[model samples]
Target chain A: TIVQTLERHFSLQDVLVGKSVLITAGPTQEAIDPVRYISNHSTGKMGFALARVFALAGADVTLVCGPTYLITPEPTIRRVNVRSAQEMYEATAAAFPKAHITILNAAVADYTPAHPATEKIKKKEAEFAIELTKTVDIAATLGTLKRPDQLMMGFALETNNEHEHALGKLHRKNLDWIVLNSLRDAGAGFGHDTNKITVMDRQETVAEFGLKTKDEVAADLLSIIVQKL
Target chain B: TIVQTLERHFSLQDVLVGKSVLITAGPTQEAIDPVRYISNHSTGKMGFALARVFALAGADVTLVCGPTYLITPEPTIRRVNVRSAQEMYEATAAAFPKAHITILNAAVADYTPAHPATEKIKKKEAEFAIELTKTVDIAATLGTLKRPDQLMMGFALETNNEHEHALGKLHRKNLDWIVLNSLRDAGAGFGHDTNKITVMDRQETVAEFGLKTKDEVAADLLSIIVQKL
Candidate 1:
């Protein structure tokens, strides 16, 4: 019975058996100086979890990561470490051609200092400002460059007009699917262990799941992706 | 000059002074027995972040929480801890009378065991299933019970049809605003440290923010809410 249950839920394992999956995790740092930089609070847990799931499902996984303290899941997964958004984009793009599925999960800095100072600016009597420019849009670039058969997904975290905004991104980025989250939802965002999610695809089908651990959500999501393929 | 520059970009002090806010955080555990129960992957970081932001803004904050490892943020901020979704509903209803703004951030479990096991069931070779029943919809319930002057927010995490579904939830729940997220987007969900978000209101206004620390996003969101007020 146990075997039957497992088989029933994961009957499509053959679909991912030889596929190469790539994932990006953590947040990029945009340096202002040697000691000061702009960054976000991503811990890379979700991306790590996805890597584990893909590997378990028999896909060759390449996890491109920013600086994170979380341990890589296992020796079977190939890991590439990077820091700034520029580096992350280069690493991801380099691996994209070989991947059957690519998940861009890094909380990359959207902007970087136009010119990074060599030393940390001293706090003098006067204030200072740093000019900034938009970082490369890795997901959009991938979307535009994707082959006909490659599966692409994007994520959106919204505080207001959540759906309208996510839909806009879905069309703008040419995503096969998109995930949406809200800051208004407690226990849902960063620095937590569990998540509740709704899955959206090009078909406009919506599937909602109750709160589950990131690992569980990753497995469930991968299952859907497998079916779609 | 520095102060002027700070004010020009964003003024943290001016955004939250006169608001009355209520927030819920952490995971609610539904007891099956005296020592065991059912729960989810909510660590309460997002809700706690909001509590800190609202408190810093000088708003009276009443935090309704579940079990978590986080330190309570403010000494004056009232906190009510509960073990189940039902208890959360009651606590939130009690705090509702005094609040002008409410953020439902808890990832409340959608279902509870129909009959909690009296003791940890010993492992058996045979398969087993536990019955489940729906938990109360805290946000929807609050929306139905809210005062006209109060602003209510909801969250939707979708894998597909990301935006239309969130918009549907906003109207269905009678929310003043809704936040949306998708897991397909990296760096956005549970157990991470950074977040990127979009905000949607009943007025159909949408605001998008780049990847940011939860604290920074909280500040930005509170600023927007204050403007609406």
Candidate 2:
């Protein structure tokens, strides 16, 4: 522990000194009404970890995050806070052109309330249904706009057919690499400080890592990205 | 501020000594699936404040709270952590018979997903509807079970017709007193340290209070309960 702490403080990897990085973090809260909302379990630990790692490596990082209580990880990092998926897409897209590398890490909701009530909806009916409409696909949209010199990556969290789902997403989003997180792994997904991840490329080359703290995972991800860069 | 702190430390009002108090606080999250949920904007500050006030005044407090990041207000106060409205109801009802006073302060969901998926529901259809069923009325259910010696109070948060809605709930739930919070008030209600409340009794005795810190509001509510006791 002491050695790790010492290493973290003493290590200065400035490989990305002139590079600009874009990252997204946290879960988007889709409003159902003034009082109620639809949200997910993402706490933004992984995304925040990535931002800290990138910032420490001397990159100019801009973090576009959804609703989360986590403070900005680094003082040098530019933080943009948004509440819904649409806002996240706009913010990320705006910063995409200037970024050398972009990481779509936020767990953006796939659907939002079709009609969010202005006031709190009173409980009158015995049975009620909430109509939801699909949200903009941030990664897919940005993927098409990515320049040849720019690198883009994203994360895939799956409960079933982990490998197949991740591969499909990597190709569909046109990401250079995709990080996979399986919920079946204990102490590995949302809310956990530790994570076990698998990195996959278009070539279907897969590199799996053991469970480690989010900081360590971030470092591993950075190491891979830096090599490619 | 120093004078108030000194008073809080020096004041030893043990009027509620040996009496058990039941209090519920925070917003219940009804599961949509493993990763998503439906929730409201209750931070549990008011409920935690009430727990602190009651505990300091020597009441044996059992605080049944929904998912919140807030820590236990007092070491002596028993805390029962719950996630959904159903869980809150079960936990509260189990402790009700022994409680001399009960305060229903939580923003319990009136509806819950009829079928929460075992796995994360994939985003497939362009439009989706989440079917919801009515949740058990914790206040009204417990109201019927209240003994002659016991006192029951509840909170009403309204967006429109505040007085009329609160009165209707107070009578319908058979509450001894109802505290109303109208969303129209700035810097008041959910997520704020300050609150503006109107306390009303069964006989229609209304006591309106200016915007005050949640702790001060808790003290005011306790004073009224102590008088009735």
Candidate 3:
């Protein structure tokens, strides 16, 4: 009985001893001018939390992050820093082939200034508009290029027809799963400390959670991913 | 032609004047003991930003928040602070009747210790566990209690089946609209400096956004709310 109990209580390390995972985090800056650019409020907390969890699970982790004030969670995890969405895309693509699981958590810009001003434009004009073009769709790109054995997850944040839109992206991006959220919901999005979420897979399985800290959520998510693998 | 050009300009204040709005922010702490508790990662940045936006738009705002490390955004906005999920629920119920628009953003802990330990238990750990019970369902409670004229918005974050799960919440919570996101999506969530989101409504309408600052997203989301109202 003593031996059986001990065997049943194996550490998380015993479960994830040799897995490799990649995660992208924070918001990619889209340069509008030398002194000015566009980005978002992704503080890198969620991604950093994921890195910690994955590392704890004994997976080798590569954390690709955008500009943020957060410190790296672990010394052993590999860190790659980049700025613009284009750079992030290139880095992610380069890292994809080597990953067993990829979490695309970065908030990449969908558009960039078609012609970024070399210098800051003066306030001479009463009104002006900058020409914009679509940035590379990072998740969709990864979806198309993903290995069959590799698990790819995407995120969707919608305001209207929230589910339909998220589903559309899930299908379009060829994701194994997609995490969805909304700005209309209160404590769930950017800059918050706690979150509530649902996990959805290609098989249409859903696992919903109530509010929890990002750390706990990451642990829960990693467990789900490990189970899927 | 000259008269038409002059007529195209409109003051920003004209857009938001005389609106009544209720906003909830932060994370609710469920006390296990006087000194210990359960909570989540809700920094309240997004909700505070929304308050600021609505205030800027000329709305009379009431900001209800759980315990957080954030300052009140405006003098005109009324602020209420609460600790437990029960307190948050009471505060929200009190404020809901008087507001025209409501945004539920607090990350209320789903479970509380069934019977909190009177003092911190001494460490003699072979194994430890705490019995948990469901806390008040803030979103669903409000949804059931909402006035017909009140425009309610909900948020969802999922790891998988992003769209389907968000839609389910939209219906479950009786939200007029929902914001959807996934944990796998980068730069869109907790503690980040930036965000990307989608907005969905009862009509199944969807508005997708690229990465933008939290402040910018707040502005955009408020604009939509105003239009819907």
Candidate 4:
């Protein structure tokens, strides 16, 4: 069991073993052309780390991801590849029903080009505009569909008013818990290996953490999930 | 001389050798949190490929880039790393004055959160509205600042009215050339290694090429630059 390797005396041997875990990672690509897209810089590091952690804890992990250079973290993990947000939604939706612990980590595009060009667009103006439309809300959908006994965790990476927004999302989405990633700290944000986080639960309790490698953050999150279970 | 490696009889040895070139690659990140960001999926392949192509042609290249998994293609390339659009603008602006050939290829976000929250914002509602404002127009600024003898090229990745929009930008930005990446072309766009490009000059002459590796596209683009020189 993964507990044998942990420094702490507390073990999640019974809680985690045989659990079904669903993790979303990477960034969704929104097409503007056959050759161009709007996307985020989610490298699948944190989410993939979580998937690995869960798998190590004897859980069955299903990782749904966007385009990336990184591969699935372990042999026991099942991976689903996707590009745009719509595709991610479909994949996640299918997997959510069976998941015991679901974590939403992918930086899904909030909006996409309303009408992708069918031909190569040539520029004639100094400034131009591309019509955009809101993408499907994947997290909200899963939050609503989750069973009472299931655990659903979400992440809110925000700047100002971070706490209030995250708290609101926790209730609005009916999530059991939410992790807040504050960009105010140095060496944090897209592509960096280190992250600082503050985890909040239903009773408004918070567990704040310092800067740590993505791998460490994964362990920290999984430990918290273990306690919750 | 890269001419020896070319399959075509035409050569650019005389025009490219020792020339100064500036190119921007990758995607600029807009922070929403200390750990989350709004960005695109620009792998820096095209810009880095341009830097490599120019260096192989004996040009002194300054490559400005955003966060990515890629490394500078060559040792001789002077690389400037940045995250946001403002940082990219400053780096490009600083390098543009000395470059004989300037290419703007970075997929910079046009708008960022007007005032990012200082703390991690939690969700309180189903739909969240993040106020945004436009970012600096790096190409237009450089276009106006460029010397008459200098050649500048821009890109227009659009969904509709491609030619008209690109043409307007050329004249409005006073650019010497512009490259259009059409989404209508299959095998082109954000994640693919192949690109199909349409080149338009100040005189409105157009050159179109089919899908090819980013490396080949770099060479083709350089050939056009050589002819213009």
Q: DockQ numbers for every candidate?
A: 0.01, 0.86, 0.01, 0.21
Question: Model 4 chain B, poorest ten-residue lDDT window?
Answer: B118-127
B1-229 in candidate 2: lDDT tens per residue? 4226324544555778999999999999999998899998899999999999888889999999998889998899999999999999999999999999999999999999999998888878999999999999999999899899999999999999999999999999899999999889998999999999999999989999999889888888888898787
Q: Comparing to the true complex, what docking class would candidate 3 get?
A: incorrect
**Of candidates 3 and 2, the better by lDDT:** 2
Provide TM-scores for the models: 0.50, 0.96, 0.50, 0.77
* Per-residue C-alpha lDDT of model 3 across residues A1-229, encoded as one tens digit per residue: 3223223333464466677899999877776554345455566778888888787667899999997768898887999999888999999999999899999888776666678775433323333444557778889998988887899877665556666767778888999888875566578867787777777788767777787777777777777787778
- Please provide, for model 4 over B79-165, each residue's C-alpha lDDT reduced to its tens digit, 9 standing for 90 to 100: 999999999999999988889999888887776667766444443344455555678888888877889779998877776777888
Expressed as tens digits, the lDDT of each residue in B1-229 for candidate 1 is: 3223224446656465677799988778765433334454456877888888788667888899997767888786888888788899889888887889999888675656577664433323233444557777888788888888988877666556767777878987899888875555567755566666777888777777787777766676676677768
- Residues A44-111, model 2: lDDT tens digits: 99999999988988999999999887989889999999999999999999999999999988999999
For every candidate in turn, the CA RMSD to the true structure comes to 20.4, 2.2, 20.4, 4.7
* Candidate 3 Cα outliers beyond 4 Å, as residue runs: A1-11, B1-229
Q: What does TM-score give for chain A of every model?
A: 0.93, 0.95, 0.92, 0.94
Off by over 4 Å in 4: A1-17, A27-42, A66-69, A82-89, A107-145, A156-180, A184-190, A198-210, A224-229, B1-4, B7-15, B30-41, B108-137, B161-168
Residue B226 alpha-carbon offset, candidate 4, angstroms = 2.3
Highest lDDT model number: 2
Best by TM-score: 2
Best by DockQ: 2
For model 1, what share of native contacts is present? 0.00
- lDDT agreement of model 3 with the native: 0.74
